[model samples]
Target: MLSEPTFSFTNFQQDAVKALLSSTGISLLAILPILILIVRQCGSAHPAPPRGCRRLGLPPGHSNLHDEFDPKYSKGTSKDVDDKGQPLWRVKALFTHPIKSCAAVELNVADVVSTGFAFDRQFCFAEQFTPDQASTSEEKTQPYWDARTLRNGHYSRLALIRPEIWVPDPAAPDYAPDLDEVRSKGVMVMYYPRPAGRGLSSYLVKLGIALRLLPRELSFSVPLVPPPDRASAYPPVPVKIWKDTPVAYDYGQHLPQSLREFLAPPDAGASRPLTLFRVDPTHHRQVFRNAPRKEELGFQPVTGFADAYPLHILNIASVHDVAARCARDIPRLSVRRFRANIIVQGPEAYAEDHWKRILIRPTGAKSDADAGVEVHVACRTMRCRLPNVDPATGIRHASEPDRTLKSYRRIDPGDPTNACLGMQCVPSVQEFVIRVGDTVSLLETGEHCYIKLLKPGEIVEGV
Candidate 1:
């Protein structure tokens, strides 16, 4: 027979104080500050690991080397505008994703389309799972994207292929990689599968080497809107697009058989070959983008594979602020984790939060609307745990950004726990080219909203 344990408050307090003064306790306290200092040093690295990384359960000895954010990218600054302030802020860096959740393609200049950036999130690889895999792992309970044959809708479900976007190191002896070389030839990517029966946790863990999906080896690009003959031959596959159900799209096997077999499991479990698709140019999947939902201030809200709005912007200052706060917890805090379309070095941290509308004009263009690109800041970007996953390693970090973010930015009522970082923006000027050096001018301001309110059955893909 076991006797009940008894506790006394006075006795407990005495023991606790004695324990704190013990040699073991004193040694722990002495090293605690030192351990914290070393970990905070990791804040300088790009593509950092999550807080308490040990709990994330990543593969052993994951590589930590990654390309640093270009100093030139720290190009822009902001000054207070008095009625009329000279264009103080400019586009520091521009990253466009030709495919959804793949590597980002850096661009010197990019054109804005009706939806957002041209070809941004325009292409995505859809996953097909057997009934068993779908039932066991996927969001089968949800009414949308609940197809065993094919699923497309959110990054939460999408298998994000973490291919290294930039390889800063040189391949040859006595030679260094040039910035020009990195811009031209990105990096090689290798695809490997997580252990079988691991389920969603496996997808969160990083895997893969740098590789490019090009025209060679069965990898090819098709027009956003395929030809009539081609469209008829491979008819549109009905998909659940947010509240809009049954959107038509042309689908095909974008990966070669060898690559498919490489990522396939040896166990021969129930799973289908990966299939890729692009936004149907015919339908364009026009969304009611931007605030108030009146119609993006004369511009249309259309998306290819983006979660909600087409454009997602991040500020270096904001990232720096977050990194500073949580550096002690998170080893490596980088802007790459947030993965914004445009990275601007603003006047102050979170300055972009107040911007309702901005116009990007030529460095010296006259005050003319037709001469520049205009974007309407949509809403504060609601974040998930993806940030904890390093872009280079594909391993999830321990609950850091989320933990620290919850401390201050827990303002989202829809999902109060979901923290926000960057602001989502949509193009108001339909078509225009935005360059890295383009100047930014505030066009309007308004109270920031917490969520992108949708109808009963609406959903989106993360950018």
Candidate 2:
């Protein structure tokens, strides 16, 4: 009788299915509220981050500096009637030096910033010779001397050290995840020619480099823009450039050992400790002389690590004139030897000498109304023995260009004893783009007498 009661297979299956369904319903009801909450959250837009946070994590190639303004405008046609039937003056070449006294970065397109080109003379190599009296107690032990340039005889090799700027591109497939980190922080990969092996090997290696057969070089990178996140890492210290003692970010601690060793080999006699320094873009070191008055400029014309003005514009025709004046045996002179930020063609020999104001129209700009950049041609650029050092070989020439230039190019009334070639300029617009084919119109011309404005009680040696 008990076995017969347990033999209802169909009814037992129905009861099992009903029990499973009841449990499943209860579980779904319990999770329904959580599921709805998640869906609502996913549909709603995310709140934007704070401005400061956004700046720290800005999109690649974007900067948040208040002074660095990016204005929107159309690049007009290059043809303009201002040429007045003369040969149209056009930008033949554009050059920027990420590191002062180093090889130039020739560009077809360059962004003009408040401090001249986007990255011109932003970084420089300096050697510590003596502790400064102005050093704070904490920094006194590791004090650094004033900034040194390629003008120093031993630093002639600096010309051989080439620097290349790398701005991250997020669109690239191999793009780094840390785009903002690389952008604001800046990246400058520098290469230096190095001798490999001995005699034949060394010669072969160098020949290969010259002939595009092999690369015998050493390279290292440094931050072109000082990282805001690591502001504390690179402490602000007073560094003298000429007579002005502006605070600069000292990258001495982070200096790569390989770079320091190469620039200042221990074997070299009495070599000072070499390190890199970057200008604080925020620091307003006004260009006192050969610059437009503050009222005329709207803002004070300032410079970073430049000898005097924000820009140095050279005329290729003038360079050719200089070459013609040089000894017949002398090789063809390169415009690069002058280290100009802008080089123009179609201008007569030394025609820039009388230029007081110039307008740089975009390649497609037809007139000033079509969006153009104005620059105050400040004064004539004074020359030193620096140009004597060949940019290609880093070898100093024995009285060639410099000697010839001094003979006839000493035309600056302010410093007539010194040779002058290029015209120092300051851009009127804070931000704009200048291209290789852009038109250069001499807006106004006047006799410019170079003058150095001195702060009260400050004495400049050998001026």
Best by TM-score: 2
Weakest ten-residue segment in model 1 by summed lDDT: 208-217
Question: For residues 1-463, could you state the per-residue lDDT of candidate 2 as single tens digits?
Answer: 4554556789989987777579666665655665555445543323222111112122334322221111110112233434554325778678788788998777777888878887888877776655554433434555556677777766888998877676655554555555543545446767786544454444544554575444456665566566666678887777767677777888787565656555665445566667677898777587766677768768887778877788889877677777677736456566778899887776777778999898888766566576787888888888888888888788778787889999888887888889989989888877788877777887899898877657546655643
Best by lDDT: 2
Model 1, runs deviating above 4 Å = 1-88, 129-228, 241-250, 261-273, 289-296, 367-371, 452-463
lDDT of 2 at 74: 11
Predicted structure 1: lDDT:
0.56
Q: Look at candidate 2 and give me any clashing residue pairs.
A: 76-364, 76-365, 77-364, 77-365, 78-364
Clashes of 2: 5
Question: Residue by residue across 1-463, what tens digits does model 1's lDDT show?
Answer: 9999899999999998898899878866765665465356434423322111111111334311123333433334544322354345766677766556565556666677776776677656555544545544434543323221112222322233433232233543323433332332333232323332244323222211111111111122233344444456456664544444334454553355544543344454544546555566666655553443444256456676676777888877677677778878775587777767887654466777778888777776766554776677878898776676665554556677878887887664545777888988877656778777677777888777565656545654431
